[model samples]
Target: MCRSGTAMRLTALTLLALLLTACGAGGGQDAQKGGRKPVFPVQVLEVQGGTVEYAISSTGSVEAFEQVLVTARVRGVIEKVNFREGQEVNPGDILVEIEPQRYRNELEAAQARLDKADASLKDAQAGLKRREDANRQTPGIFSPDEVESWRNRVNSAKADVSQATADVKIAQLNLRDAFATAPMAGIIQSRSVQSGAYVQPGALIATLLRRDPLLLRFTVDEDEARSLKQGQQATFTVTDVDQPLKAVLTHIAASASSRSRMVEVIAEVAPEDRERVRPGTFARIRIVTGSRDNAPAIPQTAVRPTERGFVAFVVENGQARMRLLTLGLRTEDGRVEVREGVKPGEKLVVRGAEALKDGVAVKIDEPVQPQDK
Candidate 1:
């Protein structure tokens, strides 16, 4: 009975040993598999060489190329308002008419005075001629002083005639100015005086604005302003309009502003686009300063900012490889120029890149596709 009991105990111990060994093997296998590096699911894009435009973006307001304050040049009662508010006018188009009756009478009076003065001048010259003839025919009949006096009288009459002629011209000018005409081709923004409103010289009549080929006034940083040149191509969009408007950079401030430290710039819109945008409308301007040809560019989303300038992940041999990028100008779109550390046709990890490290295994979640320009 003792021997049988010992045999049963040894058999149970052997069975327990085998169970422990199997458990140890299974745990070791699990640990070994768990220690292997993980493969990350990712999406990537292939780099391409394309034309990239370097641009400076800014905000600005629309302005009229020419704005003028129409003022009355003569004192009179406004008789007629020929143009309504907001009416387009051409050069020499009559805008307002003042009562000309009083000015007409003044002109007539001036002309009569001139005529009288002319007759007096003629009479004075005739007398001087008669005196000189008498003096020449009979020596010592008229003294030198007397002849001189006649000559002086003729000079005085001539001066009076000249003054009268000048007065007549002044009166004519006043009469003509009584009818105010447009000095330029523009739109009347506002009319301050109505018919029968009395106005004096320099009185506000209306405001005129040249709308065609409007000016877009914007400001830029000092560096960008320095790079800008006359006739540079640009574009802008307003909140109200879907279509972008094109313009040409025309002027740059010689010095920067004190408050904003930015230089002001002016861009001229095309005539066809002028009516679509109004003065004082806010605009977002993008000035195309230059272009890059055959530049390898990547999506902005693929670039990750690092303690060092920037880094991007590119897939090589099914592994995430890190690259330090020397970035160049960023295009208006989100594409950034890769100046160094990348090449065309390289697959850049756009998705699942943030969690990747150098030499991490990568399982491409989506096939590489051509980047839409």
Candidate 2:
């Protein structure tokens, strides 16, 4: 009876083994048909060699090409203020009119004195001619001494006439000085006087400034200024401006500042874009101190800041690969120059790289062309 019971248990155990083997084979088939390795979706950018600009960032201000302080040349009461503060003016435009009555009176008086001097000279000449004629008609009628005295009177009268003529010219000039005119075309930066105000000669009245072809004033460290050159391009932006504007380096200080060790730089804005910014406007400037042709650069977004420095993800054979980067200058736009690591023509994962590991399965879209550097 014991042997029969043992045989039944053995058969039952064999059937259980067959059923387990069949179930395992079916599960393997299901995995082959329906299950696959997980893949991370990502965007890819193919690196290409291009000119990469290295910019030095700094804060700066816009300034007028030329600035002048308008001052009164003649002292008088301000009779009429022809210009308003911040008004636009042209060359020879009337700015202010001082009281002209006194100058006019002076001019008229001078002219009358000149006319009297001319009449006296004419009388002196007539008397001299008559006396000379008497000497010719009768040698003794007028003595030589008397004739010489008449001649002296004429000469003195002539000197008086010359002095009176000079006085008339001076009075005329004073009359013209009573009216102040613009020396050049510009906007009035300030105004200091109004009607009925008395001003002395050389008193500050207004300030004028030329706005177009504006100057961009900035400074750089002495060490970095070595790469700066005349006519090199730079870009700057101000509050409320949507896009960066251009300027050209026009002036570079011959030496560094004694106090700060900073080198002053000046850039001129293009005439066509002058209206977009104003003098004294605060601006952020990017000066292209240096450049490298055919350099590899990547979009700033593609870089991952690690504890060591920075890392970027690249795609290779459907896998994500992280690369340690030795970076160079970052451009004004969101691009970074790669001094080492990652060669041109490599596929860099620009987006969807945050979740990447050094070697992880990834499904990438076709590589995109990087923007021109």
- Highest lDDT scorer: 1
lDDT of 1 by residue, 50-77 (tens): 8888889999999987898988989989
TM-score of each: 0.84, 0.69
Q: Write the per-residue lDDT of candidate 2 for residues 204-237, one digit (tens) a residue.
A: 8889998866999999998789988999888999
lDDT of 2 at 282: 97
lDDT of 1 at 335: 78
Q: How many backbone clashes does candidate 1 have?
A: 0
RMSD of each: 3.9, 8.1
Candidate 2: lDDT of 74? 84
C-alpha lDDT of residue 106 in model 1: 93
lDDT of each: 0.90, 0.89
lDDT of 2 at 222: 88
